[model samples]
Target chain A: MRGQKDIFIVADNIVSPLGGTTAENFSRLVAGITGVRRQDRPEMADQPFYAALFGSMDGEDLLTEDAAASHAAGGGFTVFERLLASSVADALHQAPGIHPADDRTILIVCSTKGNTHLLDIDDHTPAERISLPGSAAVVARHFGFTQTPIVVSNACISGLLGMITGMRLLRSGLFDNAVVTGADVITKFILSGFGSFQALSPGHCRPFDRDRDGINLGEGAGTMVLSTRREYRHGLRLRGGAVSNDANHISGPSRTGRELGDAIEVALREAGCGAAGVGFISAHGTATAYNDEMEAKAITLAGLNAAPVNSLKGYYGHTLGAAGLIESIVTLASMREGIVVPSAGFETNGVSAPLNICRSLLRGPLDTCLKTASGFGGCNAAVVLSK
Target chain B: MEYITGSCVIDGEGGYKNEKKIFSFAAGSSQPAGYLPALYQHFNWQYPKFFKMDNLSRLGFAAAELLLEGWETGAYQPQEVAVVLSNANSSLDTDYRYTQTTKDIPSPSVFVYTLPNIVTGEICIRHRFKGENAFFLSTGFDPALLTRYVGYLLEAGIARACITGWVEWLGEGFKAALFLIERKETAGAVPFTAGNMDRIFKISMPCE
Candidate 1:
């Protein structure tokens, strides 16, 4: 590991179905509140599909709310831009000393589909509204960040990779601080895509359960401000992380789970923490048959079978790019509170490999934790966080 | 402290390797169709999935392939070869296409290419690289940020080599300028400093 590996996550926020603040979201998770539900929106076809959406199932309402929250009247701002702005606003306000305009600070946006809702067309909205860079530019300008923001769009791994990027920027000494944020809202574009893959569950997503069918789509935004400066003290230290491609399939996960395992092994090595050192494992746990099985194999291969594992998809319903950030922030909260959030929908041994899946909110001091995410396009990422 | 050992540029006009115009489009070239598939055929590359990726991924993939053709990242571990790519428009072309499908049942195939880093993932899959990779979107290329990040990767001992630079596809045209940055600055390898990067980025012509 480099001499500068400790990139501290000083502040974070989550805009989800449960609540807007990270504290509210954590409390809801502890109380076992799930954001996923079946919806029969006109755009989603006649059949109802289970998903997690935020504030008024009315799509138009969220868009207007997003624009209203930004205090801008239709200058081509997007729903995600609002979520990103507010979440970052909260983090910057709470974190203290995080100057968005400083050259040493860079805003990194992560998402799978930024402003994709503009794709709905309606025969009027300009095609340029779909530009991810343009959306990022709006968010950066709104926050008065001097540096033009950078976007990471690596499917579901985008959020986890965003945090990892922040840590690397600090570790590389390229920047002293990074504002990492990501969001993805369920739209006809994504819902149909996952449906085509047969990856969506018809019922509530039962992650790590024997009866698990598929995943429930979700929407939300999350933010994390990471810094290397000692003044940003007393936060979860992002110790080590690694990303790897399965190289086995684009749409499907590796059948052997070797590459994901390799990523975890390397991250563990980089963090100077062994399998036993990780007190909790916040897995990607999409609840699809393949992903859950693959994660099980990877976890066992990394010799972390005994680590208490949890998947937050049941609560937030797999917020795509926001999944990693929401999960990481909640886990950090759990660490501070000396509690372990349960794997919401897990029951009965589902996969072949042995796992210590949390059945309930386990009270324990979690000093070190691991966060992993796998996505389409054959990508897997693992990050280590410590108190 | 290191070097950009090899670089390749591609666009609507033709292809260049280190500023030498290596491939040129035929006189009758019309790009209402897939310019990328034609280039893939010209290169005689045998990856079928290349046909599925959008222009952005194809541009980055083909550019990386060209850079890796003459230059050698010999003896570097697979994971040690990282990728750091940036672009101005983050998959806007494909985003529009995916949106068109939204009126009907959105095609999952096209929807997957909506993310910019899918290009990095494509490169990784082709080379079997299980390494660190990221895709950054900016209003324009910023050499200072790019060079600093790449330099840190090499100096921090995180990556022995990296495929880094700009790849963006917008409207009817696309641009890709990829450089293979390595740890060891050997003969003929230009030192990858901020000043040199800005110079080459402006000129973008063959070093000759």
Candidate 2:
């Protein structure tokens, strides 16, 4: 790896219906709690065929109680941004000594739909005034970060991409410690958009299942503190990561699965590990037909057919931008806790590949896990994390 | 730091028409109806679907295609290159359409294209690039930040080269520019700095 950055996952946090913090979410996942549910919103009543699964938006009220009170006054951010702020606060609380004004520290925010929900509001002025950077800018100003915070919005792979960006900045000696955050809230825009493409699953998502329908939209945020190897500690180490696009299709996945497989192989090689080294695969199993099939094939092609695989989508639903970071956090938690949570809603063995789909929480002394994700534009990313 | 090897801008005026030409669309000033017809005529792209794309996707794809044409397929692999794009208005055209639809009839098709990063995603799929990609939304063009970001990707070995620029599409018009930047051993190459940016603007701007 480009010389070990002493980066340590000093602190991490997650906010989802599965549970609030990382520990809560991991516990619920181990307990096999499926957060997917039928849409109850009156707005979606007309769309009977489509069921909207989402994380609890209760966290929005919690932000007012937290430190981001002033920024939350205007109420421009969606539930996802509040969740992101909560995760950030949780991380900062855990790492009490780290200061944003230190200059040595940086903030990297990732999301696909950063406050796009603001567009749904009646007040066009507020919506137009508050841009994606405004969310990070508010967080930066709140934390007193004088340096420019880096923001990444690379569709579904945004979470993992943020981590990679943070690693680069930290390794380049641009900052000693960086706060990497990812958040994406559900909105009519995203829901209707995916619906238009017929990518959403009407029933519970069944990743890698033979009858896998499609992904249920979910929203949440994941945040972690990454430092150089000199700052590395006992939590988890981001070994290596790579992103690749199929470029074969705009909306559809590549049939060859060459790019996705190549990305996995490249990440593993960069991490100085082999396919066997990955104890489990945290797949981007959006449960969509094309995504699941493509991911399963890519995993098998990477020679990890025997590796226990699970999609956290059942737990948190397909959290678009936050999935990568959220899943990566879950992978690390699984490694540290010695248990691989089951793919929450899987009931049948599906797909052509014989994947060791974890139906029940599997005990582990798991050392390494591969976190993979793919997006609408044929973008795919794979990141390797180790304890 | 690296120098911006080649650059081109195409707007309503039909600026660049060579084998590899960068296309720029200024919101309000250059309408897609006017420029795209000429663009299609010049590129000889017969696909009627080209006209169907919104301003953001159209300008983004055109500029990216132009930049990609300059690189030899064998010289730079898709996996080795990355796209770092920024836009001020994040899919406002789709946003506007979706908003309008909501008032009358909500169309899912128009809603899906509202996200800004779709352009980068489209560019990635078009070029098959997967290396260290990111889409930033800035207040405007900040050459220092852009240069710093591109430099970060290059120095860290994330990508051998970067296709970086600003792409903002509002209503029927847009403005898009791209730079194919590669790291240089010496300072002699044309560095993409604020000074050079100012010079380029002066050269490209209409004479008063």
Candidate 3:
């Protein structure tokens, strides 16, 4: 509640299989609906797998009618770029004072993989056009952004890390506001990779459940407009944020959970809020055995064991780069409605450390919340959002 | 203000530390292709994990090893040293290789290194660094952004020291220019400025 809580969330949008807007997605979560289902796409994987994907759309068909108008202006916009543009447009439309053309504004794009799917085509895309920076530039130009766009490509934490980067830049007087967007498509590239690691679950993912197997891959996009002005309906503000590394195995979780725990502690300290002030936690519970168990341990180590925790993976099925922002937007929705959404796929206590996993809908006042994510490269990120 | 305590650049030409030529490839050698393993073997470093790394990680790991050599006892705690890196191609080098494997059974080892930040992970694991980690993507090395971001981290007390630079690899080309930044001034240390960074990065690149 103290220090500079000037960075407020002006507006946000989420385009997932569950819905095209945050309100639609949040309502579906509250009603106990899941977007994950088994698919038999021979192109994506040989075996049937569970995932929440934008169905039956390829190339320009994935773009909305409005976004397609801009796409037809010049070079084609890849599916990944289209998602970012569509989501950011909706977020910008909701905000009153934010302008993309203003020099004081900036755009930050986050994605673990952007336009890498072009490799699937026989015609080799030029190296520059296939890069994440190239996609970011295209989106920036489409929006008429006056400043250079910054692209963050960290593993799974890219979305949250992007927001943290945006927040820091604004606080440093580098920009008056920032539009942060993240998206990743479900492609054979990702499927075969995750399939090789045996990380994708066969059915709906169950977070914090004893029988939890693995994650259900998801595809979606999310955007949030953050500004120094409080000209929006939702007064949710990003109070503090921190990033850390486990220094452990590149592809595995930390054995002790101390790394993620450290990030949460530092983020809370920076927010000037005690553990008691946190209303709940929006966890990066991908439902993988190690990830959920490690997160449970980190929560207890951070002294927030009593705060009700939930993961949106069961609904959206772990949307890679978009998970952090989509989940945060849903968390803000929970705060606005004064209700805690249930952890959709949870059945029982699974982790060794005791966590207050919310298994059912709970209506209550929420003031502050913590969102966390961990990814490949042994990286972890945590952010404290307050009302 | 912070100072650049150490720096190491490795590319087709050879390896240089603090603007001094510390290692060079033999004449008529098939360079830029066998450069990373050659450097690793030349140093006689005994880390089996080095072989498992993709070219990007190997390039970064070797450069970092040279950058932090003889500085085992750093002034800051393990969590006080941050790793902030940037590049253009990202892990596309590995992405292309991994895609080849996807034609049959995908290789998990190669699949893991598809993300650009995995290099940071490997470096952190080797050095036990637990501080902030971020990997940015741009058309080229951006000294201004790194100077401003790393400076902010040091000023805000988020990190006491930082490992900032650019490591890029695609096809047959690779470049790793890493610098260690700290608040303390050493004998050969220089002021951490955008101009200095850009100049040092250029020094690391092969002549056109």
lDDT of all the models against the reference? 0.81, 0.73, 0.89
Alpha carbon lDDT at A246, candidate 2: 80
Candidate number with the higher DockQ (1 or 3): 3
Tens-digit lDDT track for model 2 on A43-99? 543565333244333344446356457554664444555667777888888887678
> What tens digits encode model 1's per-residue C-alpha lDDT throughout B117-156?
7788788778777777777766677777688777877877
Candidate 2 residue B27 Cα shift, in angstroms, is 12
Ranking by lDDT: 3, 1, 2
Docking class of 3: medium
Badly placed stretches (over 4 Å) of model 2 are A1-4, A47-59, A71-80, A229-232, B10-33, B46-48, B68-71, B102-109, B124-132, B183-189, B192-208
lDDT (10s digit) by residue, model 2, range B1-208? 6777655454444344222334444556644656766676777765564565666777777767675664654667778887788876677667767767776656765665666767777677666676656777666666666776778777667688887877877754466667777865333347767666444433455677
Error of 3 at B185 (Å): 1.3
- Largest TM-score belongs to which candidate? 3
**lDDT tens per residue, model 3, A31-141:** 888889888888877789999988864745457666889878864888888888888888888986899899989999999887867876543778898899999998998
TM-score of 2: 0.90
Q: By descending TM-score, how would the candidates be arranged?
A: 3, 1, 2
Q: What's the TM-score of every candidate structure?
A: 0.93, 0.90, 0.97
- lDDT per residue, candidate 1, A1-387, as tens digits? 646557888798888878778898888888888988888787654579888887553333444343465565555456667777767877788877889889999999998877666565353565455567788888888777998777787778899988887887778777889999998877777787788677889989988999999999899888999999887677779888888877666678989888889889988888989998999999999999999999999999999989999998888898888898888998889899998888988889899996999998899788999999998878889999998
lDDT of 3 at B114: 95
